[model samples]
Target: MKVTDIVDKLGLTVFSGHEGLGREVTGGYTSDLLSDVMGHAAAGSVWVTIQTHRNVTAIASLKDISAVIITCGEQPGEDTMAQSNEEGVPFLGTTLSTYELTGRLYSLIS
Candidate 1:
């Protein structure tokens, strides 16, 4: 499925990086640790996290992540949004907690 599909299915807010909504969703990774994500997240995967900083986008871009879903009603900073737009990595948001959102995403993609 594409990033847009997840956005539609999960009612995710498109915070930025609209250009990458067509990017394929190959898998998912849920983590708040930057190093963990960099070590384990696969390319084209959706990342579920509460992190709202620019480094999240940096890691997502470095790892070729399809999208970053900020959960628990959190919002990304302006720098993060700009980085996401510049990197073409979809930055999404949801009111759901990380656990709930990850469950839904796993069900949707798997």
Candidate 2:
């Protein structure tokens, strides 16, 4: 599925890097541990996390993730949003919890 499709499916709102939502999303990864996320998240996957730090964007960059879904109704801070733009990573915010978001994303991206 495309990144934009996931956004629409989950009712997620784009925070930045909205233009990149047209990018392809091959899969989804749900995690909060930065190291684990970096090690396992596939390139062009949609990453669902509760993390709101700037390093989240850094790790997303390394993984080449298509988009970052900040779950549990969290919003990316200004610095995180800046880094996402710098890395061309699309950011989405939603009210869904981690597990719920994961399930929703999987149904759309799988």
Q: Write the per-residue lDDT of candidate 1 for residues 1-103, one digit (tens) a residue.
A: 9999999999999999999999999999999999999999999899999999999998999999999999999999999999899999999999999999999
Clashes of 2: 0
- What Cα-based lDDT does every candidate model obtain? 0.95, 0.86
Top-scoring candidate (TM-score): 1
Query: lDDT tens string, model 2, 22-108?
Result: 899898888889898878888988888999999988888888889999988899999989888888899999988998888877766
- Listed per model in order, the count of residue pairs whose N, CA or C atoms clash below 3 Å is 0, 0
Provide the lDDT at 102 for model 1. Answer: 96
- Candidates in order, TM-scores: namely 0.98, 0.94
C-alpha positional error of residue 31 in candidate 2 after TM-score superposition, expressed in Å: 0.6
Badly placed stretches (over 4 Å) of model 1 are: none
